[model samples]
Target: MKVLKPIYFLLALFLSFYPLCSRGEMSAGDYYIYADSVNTGGVISGGDYGVRGTFNESPIGFTTSTSYETRGGYQPMELGMKVSASSLSLGTLSATAIKTASADAIVWSDAGTGYTLSIGGVSGTSIANVSDGIITIGSEEYGLSVSGVDRAFTNDRAIAERLILASSSEPVTNSKTTLTFKASISDTSVGGSYSQAIVLTVSGNF
Candidate 1:
């Protein structure tokens, strides 16, 4: 009986380890909401202020000349935005991309309308519903600053270069893309001033 008991214990131990050894590993399946970390890529394209069209300093305010690239690392990239200020009230707002001198410089042609800055959302995702909200600051409301703020409202009717992905048609896969953002305030009444920094949050599977 003692010998039999010892054999039974040995069999039980082997059975316990057999399943573990034969266990199957996991496999990533299709259509997964892959929560990949934020792999930051690319620097902002334009930043040097130039006088071109509208101002005595030049029509173009500050032009960011750098083209943003995808941050090195993972996939399934998504995009988000934030404002440097809690609120933004301004004048004739507008945004434009920096044009290179090269006649054949292939710049993005589809400059969608500029969208509004949110606490945590995108301004324009659809072509028809592009609205960054227009604000008319009277001469009295000049230089109005807001806090907890990290974004601003733009008069420019164009999509932010950073939020503009390489493929907006569907499941975002491409990682190597350039982006930029430019804005200006021309509220004549009070000599308008824009407040807050606009920061973007890009995330997705990577």
Candidate 2:
């Protein structure tokens, strides 16, 4: 049987916003109002210490992390995602032999609190998501592995439910996540031309 498998990945993105403070405020005991002999401003940094900025008693959106860097000014909420190839093809299938293919997901986001990456199997035939498993040919297995931060496909998961594949807690510029798809077939497994369609949706966090 000349078994050929192709998986297509589609990209989608969006942005979100949080309620902004009506007015900014200053933290307690913080010298938010500095009047220097030569200059004066609402903020000042001295020695090796400084402030991260204080606004209304308002809170950070979604979550907070000291490990995450902060950016000043109004940066338009932005997100971009693309797959190296719209489709990944696994040549011919051989019994007891695993066929592997890979695609790269490049993402760029400037949204506060970073962004999320999710994937769902829009369509498939003769193959199933092996999510976190190694494809065993004779076993007729199919699955994938994602390499990058916040790897979420660590167990058998329903790809039809649009599961989060990976994420970043901080804005990323041209970040790359590699998705390696593995598949195998059995001599007894019914197969002809196999194919699957996947949609990868990227949305910015608050």
Candidate 3:
């Protein structure tokens, strides 16, 4: 009797287990991790020297030195620098000469006739041991040229068109002399960055 009762009990237990493990009706849900987060970041920046050109608004003047071997004393000299306005011009903006003040004499040697006038570095003209002076701004040349106007009369000359020199009391000597070159700048002159070096070489018979 007990064995017959156990058979029905076992059948009931199987039916209950089947419903928990395998169901005909569908039900769904997502499971995920719980999280807390933090984040961080950074940045950087920097500048420098820019491109520039030379602006010789006024006469830029300086001097060279002269030394004598068996000289009794020393002498001072005078040299003239002239700015030539070449045909090159960007509209009304033209290139002008920047003349530095008189520098000391650079001596070379004597030709038996006289002392040879020499300079360290100079630009502009074709300088000989006896002739014109060469004053340069970087690669720019400054020699004698018509100020784009007439020097025949003073009144006809304009500032932007000529370079005027002050009155001189003496000629070039062994010592250094003051020299100035004047010019007129235009409103149309290009505005921006600039830089340049000027070199003046005065050569003559001392």
Candidate 4:
């Protein structure tokens, strides 16, 4: 098979999120009864703190507001994610053709609101990235695209500081996102077996 002009890359996946609302206590049988948001609604100074509460709602006589029960028992927000691979090898760079590579990330979250996934260059890069959101074969260009819901990188985009790849507004399970990296080079482009390092971070919105 004709290999796509591929670049070598090392990647790292980090899983962490800010619990914006409640603090999680030790897990009890079912409910998170501790550290889960201080249930006090008052203006300590000029800051107005909103009250957070969990309840069992009924659709019979109400609109059945569900956000209040985001964590299902109002438990602390939770999230998990995994990358399918840690490295990508795009055989050899070509001057007359484009090369592509891809990797998959599966994420699950119970943060009530949802989660965010982003990619950023860990350090300097030798191959310049395409900033115009397009790849041309006659120039040395590198960029990335993504396939999934709430994707910010749906089109070719340069790898910048914490570039968001995808996000969700509601809780999701087994949300799989595929990231495709594309590259091109001209006859005058530099030739070498170089590798770049990047990071994928997933954050939950609790």
Q: Of the candidates shown, which would achieve the greatest TM-score relative to the real structure?
A: 4
Q: Roughly what TM-score does model 4 have, to 2 decimal places?
A: 0.63
Residue-by-residue lDDT tens digits, candidate 1, 117-137: 222334422212124432222
**Residue by residue across 136-177, what tens digits does model 4's lDDT show?**
888898888899776765578887778888899889899999
**Model 2 Cα RMSD, 1 decimal:** 22.2
Model 4 misses residue 51 by how many Å? Answer: 5.6
lDDT of each model, Cα atoms only?
A: 0.30, 0.65, 0.30, 0.71
TM-score-best of 1 and 2: 2
Per-residue lDDT of model 3, residues 155-195, tens digit only = 22211222331222224223322322322233444344322
On TM-score, the stronger of 2 and 4 is: 4
TM-score ranking, best first: 4, 2, 1, 3
TM-score of every candidate relative to the true structure: 0.26, 0.59, 0.21, 0.63
- Top lDDT: which candidate number? 4
Lowest summed lDDT across 10 adjacent residues in model 4 is found at 7-16
Error of 1 at 6 (Å): 0.7
Give the worst 10-residue stretch by lDDT in candidate 1.
99-108
- lDDT of model 1, residue 92: 45
